[model samples]
Target: MGSTRIAVVVASTGRPEELGRWKEHILRQTLQPSRFVFAVVKPSDLPSSDAMLPCAEVVYCNPGLPVQRNAALELLLGATHIIAFFDDDYVPSAYCLEGIVDFFQRHSAVVAVNGSLLADGINTAGIPYEEAIALVDANDRNGKPEAKVICSLDGLYGCNMVYRSAAIGAERFDENLPLYAWQEDIDFAARVGRRGGLALTTAFAGVHQGVKAARLAGVRLGYSQIANPVYLMRKGTLSFKAGIRLIARNLVMNHVRAFKPEPWIDRRGRCKGNWIGILDLVIGRDHPKNILSIRQ
Candidate 1:
């Protein structure tokens, strides 16, 4: 805890505007990250110019969340005490980083901590950036209690999770789980959790803007919905019960909602993809990256 160097790693593509909006909040954290790494598919994924350019490092990688994440992990391993992953559109309270630092310092056995969310926009039409920031700012002003609510969890949520670098050692994300890398967090956490403890806590918190831009095609996401969990379950990173549950939930939502889909979601495309996934499941042809080959 004495020399805890925290570094932030963000993976994104086609959302340079999101990075610009997220940058100010990251810099204003009460305990700033020792290093700021933005892993992207190309130079364009970042703003053309930024006042914080000198303080941040940009690493380009193949287009995928897991690929970019692993790139940052490789770069930050020896230099960082903790590595934090925040989605590009997320808005964290000013105390977010400081709260996490305190949480880990107090709970030495915890391998990773998934922060509580003030509000998550992923379930609906994406939250506007300004609205997300306002929600975060209001929560910050209300005061954050020191009293902690912690519980053991089988996995960490990807949007805003922090991990102890030492605990991570040589581990890496599954690069094959391309693009948004659905369920990648659960797979990563489920394995690392066995080495120590995994926790869900209120000490750290943020808002998930869930900007819908740069998302993978609905059919692709739909395909991963079924294939990835089956793959992970076989890989032993996901339990059979959990895998089945994920597969059922996604399939049902896609089908039921296809009739009256949200303007923000591609429920119809997802439904078709779900059928393709089921056929692949029976024929032994599905893979998470299979989505990459499927045409929109």
Candidate 2:
């Protein structure tokens, strides 16, 4: 057994098939996790067959990214030395988790790490399994960096984030922002950084397939896009300049893309939502929690 007790927490909703695919990739890791915890919004969301995946635990909770991720924390109180989070749509290389373990073992001062995203795009629907595997392999080959460890990153990417359990005592993902909960990872990473260093490493890497379906409506996501950063800024979790930059980028992209949206995205809807958020801000109605009023 490895000296470190590694655990994986995957928060998923309405993506059983994708969860199965992700599980297949995770099981391929060379240094296996002592616990593989899958948190779903509802128990019924997972098909009976998927319950057979070689996981140490499966938990059901209220439907929301932050809430689901936070729920997994309860299950890990005394279970793991390291905890890693992965979006259900990603496919990590066999060495991803193994490399993470090695990095934490070497860099004792580092509390959190994010892996390189090998292949991520706006659309990846209807991709065949063979094609997906080829894509991951191609990305893995091309994304290999000269330096194994890159330090002092501002935050961890939600797609592939790992943390030393000791560094996150009593800290849980913030659940106030609803749905996509934009910038939740940044908020969490910033808190973790307060304790120790944050790093992005080529040593641990994965492919974010960017699944097209089963996502929040574009308007809801757009509102969160605009409101979440501002909320974080107010809470001092995010900088004002950084928050504006993020908002401006999304505002432009959503508007421009709305004119000619990609096949898989709701660009116009997001653009509309962005407008609603801006208007709310103008009228002193800016609230990240307002996302709950939106119908899925």
Candidate 3:
């Protein structure tokens, strides 16, 4: 990547303290980013006054993953050669940025790369911030194993995805998915990578705390579990088979777990939302944005 610069973007809400706690990771990166942008819904979404991070830019936007990210994107379009998006709770290895530059330099065919994850808490209760940092630190200390491209991917994972800014040109995250914008990454990556390729890479790795805070309402997320995939399938970003599997997997899990929902999850609410979404589909309304209309 030579003189070309890499910029980082983070779209976060209600995680001011988390960002404050993790800001030092920016200083630890082996190759610093030329730009670090944060997209927030409100002023308080940033770090507290006493704990402010230096050399970072903030952009305000309505509260939705796509909209926030797109807001940040506007600032970096022609200013950078590469752009990486990290979730607020993600802790990347010290050489993460170096790995990203290396991976891109070596793989000209890949348009986007999803960093490998040492641990992801989204599937379970969620990893503690300290635990996530410990994992990242251990990786940094023991040996920053050489980063390598791992596998092909249909969509870059949202927690830690990197792309060549030139490849992105006018592409943006889809705002129609709204709020948490479930599967929005798939939609965006599919569109952006149509000219090239998408891949998973070990050139960089991170721990995703998947902190439960600031998530969308259960009804909206559950509704997205159904409607979002269908919407993507119709738009041709998601295959019919893949979309059906996603919908079925969520519906089955919600059904089976509704009787004994995890403490961290709202299985009953999600199940109700799933049913509501299905009914809407039956009535010729399968739009993903419809979740916004479902009152709490």
Between candidates 1 and 3, which one is better according to lDDT? 3
Number of the top TM-score candidate:
3
Which ranges of candidate 2 are over 4 A from the true structure? 47-51, 122-129, 137-147
TM-score of each: 0.96, 0.92, 0.97
- Candidate 2 lDDT score relative to the true structure: 0.81
Residues 1-296, candidate 2, lDDT per residue (tens digit)?
38789889888888877777755776667778888888998765564675447664788888888899888988885779899998877778777777888888788888999887766753545455566678667755654333367657888889889998989998888888776777899999998889999998876777777776678888888888888998999988899999999999989887887878877778888887888888999999899888788665
Please write out the lDDT profile of model 3 over residues 165-260, one tens digit for every residue: 988988889888998999999999999999799999879988999889888788878898989998999899999999999999999999999999
lDDT against the true structure, per candidate, is 0.87, 0.81, 0.88
**Model 1 quality (TM-score):** 0.96
Please tell me which model should have the higher lDDT, number 1 or number 2: 1
Q: List the residue pairs that clash in candidate 3.
A: 147-203, 148-203
Flag the better candidate by TM-score, 1 or 2: 1
Residue 173 in model 2: shift from native, Å? 0.7
Candidate 3: C-alpha RMSD after superposition: 1.1
Q: In terms of lDDT, which candidate is stronger, 2 or 3?
A: 3
lDDT of 1 at 119: 89
